[model samples]
Target: MEKNDFLCPHCRGHLRPNNKIILSARTPDNKVGLILLSPELGEYSVVKHDSFKIKEGEHIDIFCPVCHADLGTYHENKNLAKIIMIDEKGIESDIVFSEIAGQKSTCKIHGDQIEDFGEDASIYTNLWGATPKY
Candidate 1:
């Protein structure tokens, strides 16, 4: 895997394909959809079917398309989903990001270092109790 390849934390399956992260998503009302997320961190652009409508503050349940694993970190942070990121050098890190629609928050945690991105990132930094390093 390269620097931006995302993986399912539970099954270690590749989540990104051809520069996009493919995930199975469900709305609160049980509306199912396929979401295409940008692989680049901090890019909030999404591509989904018009039938699957999500509100700004709506909480989405993201899953791994390959293993069907629920990616939400319910025990740790309910608003976020966890994934594994394998960098170009083959180092893996835990990547957590907001699952809330319209909320842009992403973090990369490797050992004791934390790197945060997006405006809403601060909403969960305190949950880890560690300051984000540049």
Candidate 2:
């Protein structure tokens, strides 16, 4: 949602919510989708039909569209990305998602453990359609 603003860890540039998720594999061919979670509206929404693509068997590196910082990347079928998450309180954290463990998110500001739901969780979960969008 627009309620939580995502800032780049390296440059502090505002990371806008991307309705499109693009997945690129080692090969050139990629898969795309437009579905996403709108923290603004607090529900699921479809952005565009032509974007948010995902490769079937490729590891993905999610990046900031503004500053182009490497946010996080998930391994093939791992469902985890080492991305930064900013909460409604403006606290920043590193979020790692996993199929077995659900999500392990830690605040970069205080190096404290972060909760896994509510406004804070949106940062790690709403990545267009790129698998585990966190």
Candidate 3:
């Protein structure tokens, strides 16, 4: 994401790049919230306990209203833990490794299937740029 791409909706000022955005879902109520930190502006925007439903392994597209910039992407993790961006596509591209920490197993994104594990996994394709704009 570029530095001048985003602008604050309320102030119409440049939205700085902190390079990260976090999503969290509270327990019991299961309300989703967003926390955006901008290093350039040295400020943080917290949207608490909103009604947004998201699932694990899914991609989220964030945008700015003032400048209409594709801010970034986010991924929802397991449980009610604060969601983190596991993989960033355009701005930064790098291979990510995950370790089970002492567990002996090799998991791949698209690889051979050891067991049937029917209906547990499926592949999704976005034809004609049906993917999210961000």
Best by lDDT: 1
Over 9-123, each residue of candidate 1 has an lDDT whose tens digit, in order, gives: 8888888877788999999999999999887888889999988899999999998899998999544668889888888888889889898999999998999899998999989
Q: What do the candidate models score in CA lDDT, each in turn? A: 0.88, 0.40, 0.27
Residue 104 of model 1 has an lDDT of 94
Rank order (by TM-score, best first): 1, 2, 3
TM-score of each: 0.94, 0.43, 0.24
Name the top TM-score candidate.
1
Candidate 3, 99-119: lDDT as tens digits: 111112111121221211112
Better of 1 and 3 by lDDT: 1
Off by over 4 Å in 2: 17-37, 40-48, 55-58, 73-79, 97-110, 117-134
lDDT of 2 by residue, 1-134 (tens): 33555455556665444532221122124342222323332232324345445434344444555566544433344444444556678766654433121132222223533334333445444343333312
**How many pairs of residues in model 3 come into backbone collision?**
0
Could you tell me the C-alpha RMSD of candidate 3 in Å?
13.5
